[model samples]
Target: MDTAISPELATKAERDDLLTLGVEEEYLLVDAVEPRAAEAVDAVFAEVPGELRDGVQHEYYRTQIEVASPPQLELDELAAALLRLRSGVAAAAERAGVRLVAVGTAPATGQNARIVDNERYHRMRQRFGDLSPGQGMCGTHVHVSIPDPETGVRVLNHLRPWLPVLQAATANSPLFGGRDTGYASWRSMMWERWPTVGPTPYLRSHEHYLTLIGDLEASGAMLDAGMLYWYARLSATYPTVEIRMGDVMPTADDAVLLAALARALVGTLLHEVRAGIEAPDVEHPLLMAAHWRAAHDGLEGLNIDMATREPRPAWRLLRQLFDYVRPELERHGDLATVTALMGRLHEHGTGAARQRAMLASGASVGDVVDELARATRGEPGNPPID
Candidate 1:
């Protein structure tokens, strides 16, 4: 097999066949001088340039903003769109006299952890009560085009076991309230406080998926389909499977790496579904274990491998994912880019590790947030201590 992926290889970028993908990243706004979350989304969103305004929008919280890339077939095009969204939003936030930081949760909490003043969010706050207080979390959601709901459910099944590895790779919330939270991605811990936010169950078909959504709604576990916050799900509004696995990463490069992997995973599984390969039927309990382990250790420690129900180094699991999706990645002209990004991930550690490194070097929480602001804008930060 000519499996090599290089500049000379025939890539999907050079062909017409490719899967379309888009990325949605939520960011925290912090006072440029203070360590706490800043309620500046209104100002920042107003200042976003007209060209990029369509992609930039407010999230559930006034302290956060979200940017979504338009669907694109080529990895290069997707990367360019992400760069424009991140840089443009960063510039807008700065002009609003706030800093844009991409860590999954704010390093310090303030009285300003409030939701956007809208009717929908107001109802959410009333319904969820204290569960809504921790709603300040941010995440990176990747949407890959799918043909139909039936195949999208099958894709979700294949995606479940690998979701932990994705979470581990992008864990970025290590600090909260001016202290190390012990968990690598505190955002994951915060998010799971909601009734519907957890591992996606293996589905029998598209009907099964919809049935569960209706059940959750009737039971008050969720108010609507949009609140079915599984780690992966069929998008309610788009013809795409949304992978809501990772914490918001620190840089556009990190986000693009994840988006490429997600697209390749969906493509590989779509082929497998057509070939009659059974999606791995991992149990829900084990899936939950894997997610918790990943959030606790990020990429620097053991992950529960569903294949054996035993722990393996997270890096090894990530490599196994690359091997499984190598063909699809090469087909999409992303193998080389994925290869290079993995090297960087290995060298720099995850966003969580990098933030922890700054603290180990005696930087204050305010200083850590400053470093995150630089990284969020795609500026390089100091190397990890480990």
Candidate 2:
């Protein structure tokens, strides 16, 4: 398995950041009585319109389903596509007597749930047996296309430090397996367990990246380029830097704000690269530390500087990030919407905070589940999508 990325190939790859955007969202397929990842995506797939069928796929578990947005240029277009996809999935679930809940982790499954029997998943289960089943967690994946491979790698490196910021902003899972996990984004914790996951190492050159990939492959740590699973990484299939830290947001507006910020971050980094400005490098350990804080504390904890090794309040850093990307948001015509939504998130708290607040007021897990269902269906009492 001499899977080394060639220097020539890296050099030939474009490094500019183009403004293409794509999104992938994971949903929990729950039985009417038990909220778990349902193994019925194929059945749900049958109900989706042919145009959207291509983007819908089964996840690791039969209980989970994923929908991907087509490559879109405008933010509004992405929002509309996701909405339509959500509606279609919800309709399918209703007809099947199941429900699709949008959260980072499912709350009803016990420890004995069975894994789906598929070649790839079976291989994963055989290799990493216990950890494999936990992969049922849901998330929101944002893809921003970079024109070249080197720039893709560079943008990934530069964007590494901010992954935690995005994760904290979109943190939505405060419960797992029907109990409070006491973490804002339990999905981050669930994912960090896999080998070659989380933030990528800072590679000084394309050759270095090739060396790292080859070494990991040779060690059998990763099966292919797709397994690198960094919090932010260059996608093997698309010329994009994929940000995979965000939890599945409760409302479409949160999704849009997240997408807007992700695009702006990637766009800003590309601008810096073209101008020959050096991007800041944060160490992997520092990134891990920030991620831990994000999962456990959400916006309530202080973020540590990966380079400086000091703590700063997460709220302050978030404000700084919003200010930093304001120009790009404005350019995309999403600034006003992003601003208002972000303000609401800060004022009222993230979905996790709201969920916990509801529970504290004597709502059961069933109550929260009902709330999520209502929210997913765009019911009148739920938060309005932008």
Candidate 3:
């Protein structure tokens, strides 16, 4: 628990605008009756108001819808925006005769997801068939402000191992194809099927980043620069570094906690760069292995140690992760919320754990969606998670 940051950064004038952040979450639209995936995203969009219509968009699957929050300085402001987005989307979906559920994957699976009628989506399904149909998954993405691409590259390089910690913290997909997958986040495994996905190969410089992405696009494996699905990347459309590793957390409060950690990680990495601290030289394969362990095990099992790149208890890795960002979190006045979230992590476990616990108590897959749908709109749920 060192709250110490680089003295060089301490002396620099603090900018009120340094910590801007935004969150994007995708959700599955399900039939209200049997809790099966439903292809009603267009109908729901029609019900949305013209003012908030632009913020919601169609996903790869017609059953999936995405909502994005405007950039906000404080975590509370971001949470408020997300709540409104979720409620609006949920109300629209309800009116459209489908329920909006925010689990990482559809609980009552086995049916193929209907593909949206878009040219880009058509190409994706044509190129990657089975993967596209089973891709009825959702994830919570956070974007933290980075001054420029140079700093973004540095932050991404420093963020490799810790990305798994984010995975461990937000594991939510436990059921796939209507059966227990025995993995915390099956959505993470589904994402790996894409050609240009997973850990970026430590692009140390902005020039290096372009070369890496350029080679992938040239190879025809990825159709465009946007298809390079690194868990973390410099945003193509914004002055921010995007963390795309987490599943859609069950509640808006949980999503805000993930966003706060993302901002703290960015701030800490920027300060590390200023302090002349180099990112650890863990190989890309090792980094991929770490991500696998985290996605498979979540907080209830072992995680790869960032310093040594070896197996260790998940709690140990999680603790070390917080210590690295404690300084940045304190500076942003987010330490209290993060600390309380850690407590909830232990009590309620991850969303994946809660899903399984409900099943263990004889709740069916449909019942799991019932619990998830309620929590999706920031409503109170059983076991009373904070």
TM-score for each prediction? 0.94, 0.90, 0.94
Query: Model 2 over residues 32-149: C-alpha lDDT tens digits?
Result: 7655555666677677677677778777787778888877666777778788888888888877778888888876555544555678777777776676454268889888877778
lDDT of 3 by residue, 150-222 (tens): 9789888888878988888889998987899988998888888888878867776999999988898888777
Instruction: Tally clashes: model 1.
Output: 0
- The Cα error of candidate 3 at residue 45, in Å, is 0.7
Most accurate candidate by lDDT: 1
As a whole number from 0 to 100, the lDDT of residue 101 in candidate 1 is 87
N/CA/C clash count, model 2: 9
Off by over 4 Å in 1: 1-15
Tell me the lDDT of model 1 at 379.
73
Question: What C-alpha lDDT, on a 0 to 100 scale, does residue 195 get in candidate 2?
Answer: 88
Q: Give residue 321's lDDT in candidate 1 (0 to 100).
A: 92
User: lDDT for model 3, on a 0 to 1 scale?
Assistant: 0.83
Better lDDT candidate (1, 3) = 1
Best of the two (2, 3) by TM-score: 3
TM-score of 2: 0.90
Question: For candidate 1, what is the TM-score?
Answer: 0.94
lDDT for model 2, please: 0.75
Give a tens-digit lDDT track for model 1, residues 1-386: 11112333224423565677889999999887887888899999889999887788889999999988887777777778888888889999999999898889888867747889988888888898878564278999999878789989998988888999999998999987778999999999989999999989989999999899999999988878989999999988777899997899988889889999999989999999999999998988888989999999999999988888899999999999999999999988899999999999999899998888888888888888888888788776666521
The parts of candidate 2 lying over 4 Å away from their true place are 1-18, 109-111, 305-308, 382-386
